[model samples]
Target: MAMTAGVLALVLCVLCFAGFWLGRQEAVRIRSGGVQPHSLPSYYGSYVALVCGIPASLALLIWISAADSLVRQFVIAGLPDHLSALPEGDLALLLTDVRNMAYGRVPLNTARPEIVGAVEHYLRLGEISRWLMWLVVLALAIGGLLLGRRMVSAEFRARNAVEQILNILLIASSTVAVLTTIAIVLSLIFEALRFFAKVPVTEFLFGLTWSPQTALRAEQVGASGAFGAVPLITGTMLISVIAMLVAVPTGLMAAVYMSEFMPGRLRAVVKPVLEILAGIPTVVYGFFAALTVAPLVRDAGMAIGLNVASQSALAAGVVMGIMIIPFVSSLSDDVLNAVPNSLREGSYGLGATQAETIKLVLLPAALPGIVASVILAFSRALGETMIVVMAAGLAANITINPLDAVTTVTVHIAALLVGDQEFDSAKTLSAFALGLLLFVVTLTLNVIAQRVVKKYREQYE
Candidate 1:
């Protein structure tokens, strides 16, 4: 049925194009006879094409979406009264399986006559829907062509109409992207709400313990899986701090060097090398953190007589910080470079040393962009999963010491969903709640970054 509907829709579209060509030919003939229209022949063609295509295409889409459900309803009504007694949800599932079986994709396990009858009805209804859809599309296309042909005349302003339609279509296309973002956020919000209902928001927010594993069977014994998210939050914070410690100075210095100090020939060589850091996959970074960096950190800590887990927050955080350095340096470098050369020249004319000019003038002027870069880096650090999962231990220690093992929220979420988990369990729902919290925190940071950028622009302008 879907294939039939698609083919019919394609036929209508081709016919619309033919109508457009015919309209253009007629318009050219009129112009040759010295009764030129207000718009060019091609504009008339587009206008006719739009008229024939848009309405028919819309009708085909609506029919395709509605046809299956409508057919299923009729089929269900024809089913035996005993079959109708089943709950609507179960009935829908059974019908779906039966239809799948009828299509030869799968077979129903049950041998009930009602099920067999329903499948047969479903197939017949599908055939009817296909035929009806083709007829509707043909009618819409023909009507649109006839109407468009009547409007083609010397006084017609086809170009203006076509442009107006295009403008509306462009806005509609852009709106779909914005609406999709909104829909995704709303879905996250609702799922998170369901999670929060199972666990107290305060406990999820501020509890110190971080264990999320719960007993699978009634016979199992342990602390009813600690949902205290504090450890995860602390781990995230600690890793972010470590990342910033590594990234900020290195990234800022690199930006400063690139913008104010490096000669062009050297800059060309160095900039691409630095940007190559940004292209490295996070999974590759994870392996480096897990295999190379974590062991090294463990050995270094042992040498210093400090207790460090093999997978420690410090190792992951440091690697993550290294991963994000390019993000900070590149954005900061561009913003710094955007500052006018006049500012540097004036500072130099005033006898300020190059270092002094960069430190006092350019740095302060580019502060907002620099701060935005830091916030963006921070968000990335907080949201990082692979490095932390590979290098940081799963144990959720509430302590802030970087040498100790810790679990982050992202790692916890990943662990919870990695296996088949019952949907209603606190362990599973906690992932959604954590995701919501993550989203909120990142969104807040982004909003603040935008505001800071705006303030900076206002100050400079």
Candidate 2:
């Protein structure tokens, strides 16, 4: 079946390529006759290729989804009535075992006659389906090419037709991504609903305690599980707040220095180094937070006559902030740079000092982008896992102090599913609940950032 699918894909690819070549040749032939049209020759080629490829690709996708079920039904129909009466899922599993046996991997119960017959039928149906698909695809491609060729006349508006088709194609491509996002959100929602069924939704949302271990057996003593998410949420918010405190001022200042103040040579040398901060792995940042930053923060706090845990929220948040500085600075710098030089010149022309001009004019003009960058950085900080895990303790404490150790949603989720837990257990289900929360938070931040950036663009343009 894999071989047949591969061959069909390869044949379709060749036909599409041929259609592109033919379309281009026809466009060039018409152009050589001094009859220029709306679009370039490549657009015509793309249009032909798209027409020849899209329908066949869609058909192949549908066939791949349904072919196994169709084959299994046919094979099952020929089996004994008793065997056919099994549950759908059970019958499907049995058919899967038969296919495995046919491929000589393993025998399903020593290869009974029924299984052997089903396997034989499966292979026969697969071969027939492949042939039929190939014929249909070839005919479609040939028909599309012939139609395109007939349409390529002296007065034909191939360019407009091609562009309109391309517009639809682009929209279709974008819709796939949008739909995939919707599907992911829906899946998370259902999993979270399952978790809320086991644990009360209000408790998950508002309760302060977060121990997820429940009694395994009915007779277990003193094993009531707490599902309060307040601690995890508190830790997440605290860490993100500390990270933003460190990142926002530093990043904005850096962007200001680079975009408005720095000389060209220094800017050239510094921008790449700043960007290199972004390329460093988060796991490496985890190690840096654990081994270097946490100890330093503890020592510094002790020197200042304050009590601090060895693994503190301050250390993790600060390090994560450093990791995200590049994201904020680089994006802010680009947006600042994009602010028209004429605006700056106009400000300078009014005898405004560079400092005053930047503070009153440039910063206000670039405010939306800077806000977007900060929101983006906040989202990154919230989603960070490794740094917090390595540098902060797993204790879910409802504290506001950065010097105290705390657990975060991501760390809790990681701890829950690190090795293996039963899928139906509350512990495992809690991970999905946390994942749903994380997804929603990040998605909300992204939506707001996009809106801000769009408004900024509109304001300036």
Which candidate number has the best TM-score? 2
Q: CA lDDT, every prediction? A: 0.86, 0.85
Residue 312, candidate 2: how far off, in angstroms?
3.5
- Evaluated against the true structure, the overall lDDT of model 1 is 0.86
264-356, model 2: which lDDT tens digit per residue?
Answer: 999999999999999999999999999999999999999999999988999999999999999899999988998898889999999999999
State in Å the error of residue 140, model 1: 6.4
Candidate 2: which stretches are off by over 4 Å?
Answer: 1-15, 33-40, 63-143, 214-224, 263-273, 276-281, 287-311, 414-425, 443-461
Clashing pairs in 1: none
Model 2's lDDT to the true fold?
Answer: 0.85
User: Considering only N, C-alpha and C atoms within 3 Å, which residue pairs clash in candidate 2?
Assistant: none
Candidate 1 lDDT over residue span 352-420, tens digit each? 999999999999889999999999999999999988888996888877888888878898888888764
